[model samples]
Target chain A: SQKIEQNSEALNIQEGKTATLTCNYTNYSPAYLQWYRQDPGRGPVFLLLIRENEKEKRKERLKVTFDTTLKQSLFHITASQPADSATYLCAYNAGNMFTFGGGTRLMVKP
Target chain B: NAGVTQTPKFRVLKTGQSMTLLCAQDMNHEYMYWYRQDPGMGLRLIHYSVGEGTTAKGEVPDGYNVSRLKKQNFLLGLESAAPSQTSVYFCASRSQGTGELFFGEGSRLTVL
Candidate 1:
């Protein structure tokens, strides 16, 4: 079975600092990987998607890097603010199926 | 536009009772999914349909059933509700050739 391991269950970071989250997977090679942000009482919103062939993708203050060799993906939020606090989920797209990691909760303190 | 809509935003059921959650999408997406969100468990896939009349089991399909009779509508059924089934349910749709999933607000189900 494919397993996705996220760095931590929860992380606390100071505002304006860069927050980095890690996701590592094993036993499967995904065609693409996706990142999502989910606030409390809400469904997850898509943040970014990086294909296996793509090294990195960026949008605004968010950046995602996919390393197929290490079977890992890193998500970074630069100059983070309190509003950036939420649970982040990483998903692996194995052909027609999609699997999600447990998610990491991030708290940005002002 | 209402990208994806889930009916019965909140529902409560006694053990062994049965009910269904409705999900509709206006985007004409070919793939529809049913997922359950539990505290600390992220989201678990229940069942999904690649197209109308096609349903496939997902990671956590044991206690749930799904049907996609129309391209825009997908239904999830709980034959015998259990306390373990108490969780927020989300419906999502995706167009072919895209990796992004548009999700409904979600249905909060509480099985007592």
Candidate 2:
């Protein structure tokens, strides 16, 4: 019965700036959270993942922060480029199954 | 490595027709999943397999049935397709560590 929520609106930002996206959930407490990027006509590609016990995780230009108390996860893309423009999704495991958020489309303008 | 592959990238079926989507993984993963993506609903789990010969229902299994005769393949069957069932389907596989799920390109289906 986990319900994951993300900003359905598209995010527009200029180049060289940071883009931040949010993911929230209710009714279930997941042990870990994950982020993925999906281009048009393709399935989501994995980004970063953070655990409930961990405050943050990072991979190159991508960073993910998890707040268990807030039941939220924040994904940040530093120095975002046009190539990074895609729908970013946040997911959490409900037991062995994965539940995903609605997703936030990040449009990085050059 | 052809992590995950789904058959028939696109398809069109009449209402009340039936179809089966095939998914295969080469990663030797123990878990395989099927999901549907809608405009604003995100990805909803339809069915999943824990291992060879074992399948389980997920968040939205209605109107769909799944079979896993082998550990490497998962099949999702729609008994009677409806317009509402027209959504992009994705297949994914992962191991026990809960690492990022490896996904297929997705199958686009339309029911007229």
Share of the reference A-B contacts seen in candidate 1 = 0.65
**Global CA lDDT of candidate 2, please?**
0.93
Give residue A56's lDDT in candidate 1 (0 to 100).
96
Candidate 2 docking class: high
Error at A75, model 2, angstroms: 0.4
Q: For residues B22-83, what per-residue lDDT tens digits would candidate 2 score against the true structure?
A: 99999999999999999988999999998999999998999999999988999999999999
lDDT of 2 by residue, A12-99 (tens): 9999999999999996669999999999999999888798899999899998998888988999999999999999999998778889
lDDT of 2 at A110: 95
Report every candidate's CA lDDT.
0.91, 0.93
Q: In model 1, what is the error at residue B108, expressed in angstroms?
A: 1.2
Show model 1 residue runs off by greater than 4 Å.
none
Q: List the candidates' TM-scores in order.
A: 0.96, 0.97
